[model samples]
Target: MFKVEAIADSYDQRVVDVDTGVYLEWLVTGSRYTTEVFNLVHPGGMIPFTTSREYGVDPHTGLPFLVFRFITFGSAVRAQLRTKHLINCTFTDDLAKKFWMTVAAEALVVFGSAYNGFKVPNRRYTRVEVNEKIYTLEDFGYTTSPG
Candidate 1:
């Protein structure tokens, strides 16, 4: 008899305010791992606010920023490492067209993999690619990195 392993992961949800074609406060709930990483990922795909004080205005850009702090437990691992992927549907006109093409291609990849009965990792998602560039919250205007 062969044994198979099943790994279980947790998920959480938060509320994100959409206005000014940017991002505002976000309600977050999840494991420390998921929450912290999600915060660092920047919900709106933009950078967080940064300031001299905990919450000060940036002199250079004149945009209010925030300095975030988060501490994680278990194995002394760093709490707020950002992920390098942007999962969005918006793009420049040129990029948008290419993005849709990539989406089609990626969908085909997923369908083909599924058709072939390939075993994909449980949490792993195969999605569209964009310019090999990682998207951040700063691109859309998100302040406050998660810890």
Candidate 2:
């Protein structure tokens, strides 16, 4: 038999904890979006890192001078973005990821709702054609996503 409660809980947990870090970074960079846009990815619940500025180290000194410079540049970009200096702007990765997260949350609800009124099963049925043909509502459709 399957359990709907367990499946709904598991799906809910996955929806609540999916990570949006990489997605957010991509959104900010104005990159092409991938199908991973679904809400069931990593970290779950709440946005992960809000920003993702990369850094580089020198081959000789192994220092992060390049990274520091990049951070400074990012700060300037952020300021410009906020001050309306950057108009007709595309959504940042973070914003895009957030958008997807919202979409995913909605999808999760739909997924759960699809199973409403399903009854739990107490026994397993063998994979036989005759068995299936003779089964009734009370005898089938109770397996949940989660065990």
- Candidate with top lDDT is 2
Number of clashing pairs per prediction, in order: 15, 15
Q: Write the per-residue lDDT of candidate 2 for residues 1-147, one digit (tens) a residue.
A: 222233253443222222332211111321221111121223433232122222344466554321100111122243344343322223367666445444333323222212322321212211111211322223344344334
lDDT string for model 1 (127-146, tens) is 22235542223332323222
Estimate TM-scores for all models: 0.19, 0.18
Error of 2 at 10 (Å): 23
Q: Flag regions of model 1 displaced more than 4 Å.
A: 1-96, 112-119, 125-128, 133-147
Q: What local distance difference test score does each model get? A: 0.27, 0.27
